[model samples]
Target chain A: MKLGVSLYSFAGDLQTGALTVDDALRYCAALGCEGVELIGEQHIPNWPNTKISDLDHINDLCKELGLEIFCFSYYMNALSHYDRRATMEEHLEMVRLGAATASYLGTRIMRPAFYGVPVENMIEMIKAGLPIAEKYEIIWGVELHAPFPPVYYIDALEKINSPWFRLIPDFSCWQTAGAAGHFQANDVETLRPLLKWTVHCHGKGHVFDEHGEEPNTPYKDLMNILKEYGYEGAVVAESEGWITNYKPTLDVVKTHFKLLEKYGR
Target chain B: MSVELRIPTGGSYALTEQFRELGERVAFPDLNLHKVEMDGMKGYEFKLRNPWYTEFPVSCAEDMEVGINGYAVQKGKIFFVIRDQAVPFKYAKNLYELQWGLGEVAQVRMLDGQLQAVVKEANDVEIKFLLRTAFEGYHLPNNRIEYEFKRNMGVI
Candidate 1:
């Protein structure tokens, strides 16, 4: 499995103007990351209305750095309306836009978080965007976050059993420690069944121990499970320590990469 | 020596109490508020941070109230600035096209003469608005959550 870093890990720095998008990509490259993930809105200036020139510049930069753009994450705010949720057409348009951006970034995987939207609505939106996904040669990886087990989306995944539709199981789901009760841990074995559908993954890390290991997540077990299932996709290191513990993101991200190197298969 | 009985009421507990009190008054963080010049009018500008993980439209902002040093500014005097276009706060609800991207900075500028008194080097700022989050309002009573952000920040 290839190890990578998500630009979302440096959200704090990006928001504070401490790091530009170029700076972040270079930082990931310097860390010896073979690939990187990006959140469209976070890294792309004037996102959804993104300029082709900017996209081309980013593509060139990644090529220059020899870093693969593994995945581009998207967020859908279905509740953007004041009195109602966004229409199906609106959501589908967003998907198309996201897919276009992901295609331009030279990434085959797109992870979208449909927060506040029902699963049924989410499925419908994905189904509507399948043509766009196909056209862009992009795969949709629905993120499996905490408080919800992998089984929560099994029926949905089975119903829409297309290669284009898959899962991106976050390590936070298998967290045995460090969440402080905000999330419930799912048995590591539960993820075994969903491995076939997982195209990408989020290696969510919070606080690191003195030994440069994540105290909250079982990285070794997670790596073993992915390896056992023949999952060779990129495991992107995503650090939430900046938001949770107020730790410097650069420091936490560096430690996370080391932890990934130690356990990443 | 006689032992003096002392009630421990300091450290984290005191700090927590102070925060609780401050929480009731402030709406957003100090870093989000800045003093800027817009249209040659010098005043304070407050950035609207997407409270949720995903991006939402600026139209979701409703019933906004801005307080500077304990004085509330009239809604007519406030403007919601996104993409360099400023719309009156009262009419922001009709702007369905203005999307506030995640981690993107959108400003609420109070540049009228009314703010001249409080828009100084350092001031107390408070912003309160009801965020119509999905269908939470339809299912629960008074669940159209009102977000309150407050900070005593340097505006220079």
Candidate 2:
């Protein structure tokens, strides 16, 4: 699988002026990652409304750094601030827009999260986004998150069975030794079935210990699963440092990427 | 602790009155939800549904970001929407009775390096009532033309 760093991993760095847009790109290159994912709203200049000139700048920066733009992450909601149909329609539009944005960002994959969204609503979103995905040359999918599992979407994925409808498993699904730190440990067994449908992995990492490793989740078992499955996709590190202070969150991210390379196969 | 609101574009969106107040009160940074069609949603609306909290271990996760879209600011004032108020869910209570029913004052307590807000689990529908009224109190700055109805309602 290809190794990458999610701009999300360095959210702290971005907010603290420790890294600029170009700086983030260069950091990933320096770390020897093959690709990068932009949270889109955060790192991209004029996010949610970026100018072509800005996209050009980002494209050029990635080119100079020898990194491929792997994925773009965005958000989707199912709550009806209005009526149900209105909410569903709005979300569907977001899928299309997110896909178009991913195409502009030079990636074919766009990740969206639909917290509390019913599976039915997501299915509708997939159907609505297919045409746009085909038009934009992008694939729109949901990230497998907690409180919700990829399994819940199994029927939906099977029903749709399209490349545009897939899962982006964040290592969040497995119990790294740190399952307690985030959410409860998911049955790693539950994740096996979703592998064939997974186009990318969030490759999440938490606080590290004195041993210079994440103590929360078991990386070896998680990596072995991906490797054994014959999976070969981007393992984009989505680091969340458990330390409160300005700990080098990027270090944890780099470590996660290296671990994936070592075992993610 | 820092909080970030990640409002998505490709639709109309506005901040909740209470959330806007909190943002202003706390001086949270502002971001433009750019290239958006101001006409995405014709009027301001709020969802009574609660946020899905069980999706992730938010306690140990990084900063929280709320996404919004296709909602337009009606008349210069953002339309107020009710978010999950951490209260027990109920239905059918009128706003006035619900307002009078508000209870459970909260204080943020830090336990194990996490910010925890302890509030009494609201019984009945008062939480929604209190939340709905926050909209009664807000008006976007320099957007008086839209909030004129509030002045007529003696809401000021």
Candidate 3:
């Protein structure tokens, strides 16, 4: 499987001006990532209103940096807006925009989430996006989180089961041993069956000790599961520990890289 | 900073009369509002801080202060609660982070071609914090408040 980091791991740092995109790329390469994921909202200047040239510039930069831009994270939710139909229309346009960006970024996979909407509704929304996705050769994948169960999308996947639809399994769904019941981060056993539909992964990392100890998340176990499934895709080091503490956030992110080195195939 | 409380015209969340009846004065505090501005949804990433609140957009550029505490939901009713120091606002960052992005807490949905915000706070304080600066730093007020083109009371 290809290994990488989502620049979002540096969100706090990016917000604080501690990390620059250029340095982040070098940092990812230093950590031995085979590819990388991009968060458009944080990275793009004009963002949703970005010009095509800007997309081309980023794509060219990634090529020169030798970083494979595996996926562009585009989020769409049919339920957030007041008008579901208006929201649907808005997302249909967003799909076209995302596909255009993905085409320029040199990646064929775009990760769009189903936020606060039912599985059927989310699928219906995704169907609206498929025509554009096919046009750009970008595959639309849903990240499996506590809120988004993989099974929920199964019926829809079967109905329009094109190679364009896929899943981005976030390891946070695999809770740490004895973390908290409230987190709703799933266990490996529950997620094992969902692997068949997974195409990419977000190695959501958190809390690492100085002794190279295992953090709350079960990275090793998750890596093994991915291996068992013969999965080959980008594993983005997506961490969130930076929010609370200014210190040790990078340490925790580093731990993810270490764990990946040890267990990731 | 004071926020203009717009009354619900007509819905299950009609909160105009309720907010006008609020006998308590709402206080304000430093808050990080979560607001999600729809720009075709530029991107998605799970922030470890608070996933539930993540969808809501909060701006460092915007001041975290408010004149009123915010809105609350009790037994299926929405109320404007004052942010009193004695009764602090409940920062459910942890709960919001854990409860699957807390989709049930303060949501936006469709009703008769209109977009309405639906919020279900666990407690009065949490709802206040939510409304004042919870997600977008605003709440449901049941008072008839409007500014005319001349910036005055009811006029033609």
Could you report the Cα RMSD, in angstroms, for every candidate shown?
A: 9.0, 15.5, 15.2
Q: What C-alpha lDDT, on a 0 to 100 scale, does residue A238 get in candidate 1?
A: 91
Tens digits of per-residue lDDT for model 3 on A112-177? 654523456766777777988998888887776533343556676677788888878777666653
Model 3 agreement with the true structure over B1-156: per-residue lDDT tens digits:
121222222321322222222201111111222222232331111111212212222211111112112332222121111111111112222221111121112221101111123221211122212221121112223111111111011101
Off by over 4 Å in 2: A77-86, A176-183, A242-246, B1-156
Each model's C-alpha lDDT? 0.73, 0.51, 0.52
TM-score attained by model 3: 0.62
Which is the better candidate, 1 or 2, if ranked by lDDT?
Answer: 1
Better candidate by TM-score, 2 or 3? 3
Q: Cα lDDT of model 2 overall?
A: 0.51
For candidate 3, the docking band is incorrect
**Worst-scoring 10-residue span by lDDT in model 3 chain A:** A77-86
Worst 10 residues of 2 chain A by lDDT: A77-86
Candidate 2 or 1, higher DockQ: 1
Error of 2 at B140 (Å): 24
Chain B TM-scores across candidates: 0.69, 0.17, 0.16
**Over 4 Å off, model 3:** A77-85, A147-150, A177-182, B1-156
CAPRI quality band, candidate 2:
incorrect
Q: Give the TM-score (0 to 1) of chain B in model 3.
A: 0.16
lDDT by residue (tens digit), candidate 1, A1-265: 8899998888766654566789989989999999999886677766666789989999999999999999998666566566676777887888888888888888999976675124666577777878888888999889877655556677678878899998998888888733732236667888888888988989998788999988888888888888887788999999876543455568878999988888874
